[model samples]
Target: MAQSFQFETSTERYRDEHFLPYFRNGVTRGPMTAETSDIDGLADRSRTPPTVAVVDAQSPGNVGTIARAMKNFGFDELLLVDPPALDPDGEAYGFAGHAREDILPNATEVSFDHLVENYHTIGCTAVTNEDDHSHVRFPYSTPSELPDRLATVEAPTALVFGRERVGLTNDELARIDEICSIPAAADYPVLNLGQAATITLYELRSLTLTDEETQLPDLERVRAPEPTIDRVYDQWAELLEELNHPVEKREKTMRMLRRVYGRADLTTGEAIALLGLLRRATERPAEQ
Candidate 1:
């Protein structure tokens, strides 16, 4: 069943008046369009990644999945509120994969109030209001926008996810400083608890991880140098010339070869091998 909640506007005025201007400006808008200046200003500021917090989570397996997602995204700290037993031998531990060694075992159990008081809490929800009439879910940032919204802050923060069944209560969301939502079809926006957590964490990974930390192969290392690529083009021209490829058509053929090689993004080794083959073709006696 999709978890849906009706929110009251009793606290809307309070949030508008008390919270940061960014939040107020975000109301009635999608993805904080008017807050670009605010976000850009904070772009170079120090960043402290938020702790992943699950509230009133009923499923141990879901909790484990969240932990694994955290590990994949370079986040470590986790806080649980009213969580089920995560026995070492149980589903939580079993599903945690490598995270059981660190994120799950070291998770802290804290009250919702404690989470709010100690950190800048951003609640994750699938539901949101379209207009400024309600503050609880309106003016929410989508998960992809979180890194920009949070890039400047240095304070401790928590990315709060609610129960698998009903999600966070309206009251809990009312107290949260900000709201983050994953964009989905309007008719059925709800996502599985673990999937929601995973997607949100993946979006926020830029704040927690550096390019070097990800250890992905550098493009410079894999791609042939411009000079090397030029050599391949030169070789192609030579091969075409040796074949008595018509002079009028040779230039066009070379142009096509350039386009093909440009799109291929051949590696250095591949380029060298192609150069050798082209040389051999050019050197071979004309087949008569």
Candidate 2:
């Protein structure tokens, strides 16, 4: 049977004690919004290159705002991999202003793997330090380095982002070169996806100062290698069959592990380390 909604008998008292004053004072329940005035003069376009992609973006407004930001910062190619929803003529366009008409229609949509495959280099952003993020460059080097990197970077550089609710998945995390993160106050570290992308692009634009700065002389145009996930417990599949561990139990354990590691935003290096740990653990004989 379907569950039915339940009403509290003390609702009137609860509201009087709790919600009444807040409502009367014009306070409402919702997420905080960052306040800012006009951004026309402040938006910089020279920092970003022609190749950038946002993956699995969940919000329609976020998608449009990010596209608008890309246009503001002189970025051309925008890829959306299985986005949650999009509104071409909604608030996104309102924020986009002139760029909306051009970008919203032509923005490319592709499978996540296909987008990663096309990019010469791919990078991701994360908030926490996991094994994959052990090598963090303080002050965030991507912005400073992007101009030089761009001069020599080949077509299609993937900038993988995550869902608003949870960020990127482990499978997605494994597909990028490095996991980039903004060092914010510990009290409020996670940034909204659109804001993070916008800031990152702006920082990269800031670095495009001079001809000397823009030239990365020796960097070669090598294709970014694809990232892969090797489930260590695949071996456990056979062991579960042999030892008769319940299928549901094995699956639950695997899913929980995947979620934990996924949240860490594992980069290629960290994934390797984690896989090594798993390999060692799996090599031992099953408990009696």
Candidate 3:
């Protein structure tokens, strides 16, 4: 049996009772009209990424996994509609990893209509129409394309996913402003709820994360300096000479060593260690 959908008529009461308090601390939600400009400037305003909303998610563990994925991609605000009970010591918290501390605990419960009224809702679905004849799911954007498409909009947005089994019904998709689908093999395009959210969040990471925030190690700080690298090459040459490498092959061997080192992207410490080992090898007497 298909689930019935209804739009909530009392918007202000719902917003006041359920929505406003969750955002009072730091999350901002309001209409972003043309005349309304953020006092912090557009760049700062655009930094606010889309909220992640799961509609009628069945499993607490899946919800937790989605929360974990949200943390991985720098998104914090999560909205749930008919979600499972996330006990402190339950699978939801266990699977949430670091997200249990913030994302899962702070997730707000909202009605589907609250999302429609308060946000530019983008429905994520595996099933899409093949042609423009049906507007409900046609003209959908892939997850990778969302960043450029949503770059300038300052309004609050929501990436809405539906139930694990049926997903969002036709009626719900019809009400959503936009649709986003992940491209997959024709035989099976559907993904696990957590997987779908993770992939979509990853593709949209550029919207929420900065270059400094995403990089693992500061490349400039770790890369070996030019002089240090030169010393490594010099040490290699000295070691080769000490070993009495073939005269004709020495230059080629040195060139090969340079290529290998160039591709290694060795850190300053690694270069120094290599230089030390080479120096010791060059100075050590051959075994009699």
The most accurate candidate by lDDT is 3
Models 1 onward score TM values of 0.74, 0.49, 0.73
Per-residue accuracy of model 3 over 108-161 as CA lDDT, tens digit each:
998887777777789999999999998899889999999997775545678999
Please give the CA lDDT of all the candidate structures. 0.80, 0.56, 0.83
Predicted structure 3: lDDT:
0.83
Candidate 2, residues 1-288, lDDT tens digits: the string is 001112234655533532332232242211222311112211211222445567777677787777777776666566777865556556666666666877766677777766554454445455545543544422233444555665544232455667876777656665555455655777887789888788777766543344344444554333222343444336435445666778779888777766775565556666666567656655667688
Checking candidate 2 for backbone clashes, the offending pairs are: 45-73, 47-204, 47-205, 119-156
lDDT of 1 by residue, 45-132 (tens): 3444678999999999999999999999999889999999999999999989999999999998877777776677889998888878
Q: What is the Cα-based lDDT of residue 203 in candidate 3? A: 98
Ranking by lDDT: 3, 1, 2
TM-score for candidate 3, residues paired by index = 0.73
Residue 226, candidate 1: how far off, in angstroms? 3.7
The lDDT of model 1 is 0.80
In candidate 1, stretches whose alpha carbon ends up further than 4 angstroms from where it belongs are 1-47, 185-188, 217-223, 242-246, 277-288
The candidate, 2 or 3, that scores higher on TM-score is 3
